[model samples]
Target: MDHDETGCQAAPEGPILCINNCGFFGSAATMNMCSKCHKDMMLKQDQAKLAASIVNGSSSSNEHESVAAAVEVQVTSVEPKSVSVEPSFSFGFGSGESSEAKPKEGPNRCTSCNKRVGLTGFNCRCGNLFCAVHRYSDKHGCPFDYRTAARDAIAKANPVVKAEKLDKI
Candidate 1:
């Protein structure tokens, strides 16, 4: 029969207890919060719901008011663990480029592969140089401003938009 500072009966030891007199019990939630604070939080949630209903012109007692305040309470809190990790995309050749500006790469090495791009080579719009095997934008992972043009072109030609009007006509 131990009552907390709020005059609420403290939950019996070794049990998760909710804030209200109803004493919501849970095994997963007992580690952090005692019952009293949980009750106050629930009360604030209910009050918010009531205020929302009033503002929406839906009488709280009218059996079906359109306004509703939904509050979700999670009792059990999880602690996140910290760990260091490295990205797997590293090709083991030193951490790529520090600058976006395509250096005077001498038109030799394919960015995707360190192979010598001889006669068959392509320079992607991303300004990087690559061999025929990784020439296309996708093959060499081209990060450029070209996507917006393609997206705009598709929208302009969208046949499903029946309401389209041509200004030229």
Candidate 2:
């Protein structure tokens, strides 16, 4: 007969009452309890859990404090002092120090043709990087058994279901 602010007709019987008997409309969520009652219940539960934790923690507090004290003493005794060092400069090229070395092969290079594939390179199951041309298993002669893997996946997805045998009276 009456409509709410959203212009939807109110329930013919009545608004659903809260299971907590709080005289408020029940929310399907929060297990049919009103928002206020649900919030209060949650707060009470949290306080109870906190009290239990405090009661349990009191027993182990002394052990933790002793370990913390030991750690603090060790940290204080081994305090590191600041040290300063001047940088040494070398003005010679090819100084036999070998600061940088060039690698024969890099990840960006394709293993098939040694081409610089960069981000376009594909890592095959054969444990080698290949360009678009040789990315397929057939192209690189990949040793991994794809047929066995496919069969296992199919078997796992479609499990064998056997009906239970029933004895006739």
Best by TM-score: 2
TM-scores, all models, native as reference: 0.26, 0.36
Query: Candidate 2: where are CA atoms >4 Å away?
Result: 1-107
lDDT of 2: 0.68
Q: List the residue pairs that clash in candidate 2.
A: none
True-vs-predicted CA distance for residue 111, candidate 2, Å: 1.5
Per-residue lDDT over 89-158 for candidate 1, one digit per residue giving the tens place of the 0 to 100 score: 1112245543234557464788789888866767777887788788877777778868797898888898
Give lDDT per model, in order: 0.58, 0.68
Could you give me the TM-score of model 1 versus the true structure? Answer: 0.26
RMSD of each: 21.7, 24.7
lDDT by residue (tens digit), candidate 2, 14-115: 567789897898766777788999987997785465445444765277755543332222122332674443222222234465533466765587777888
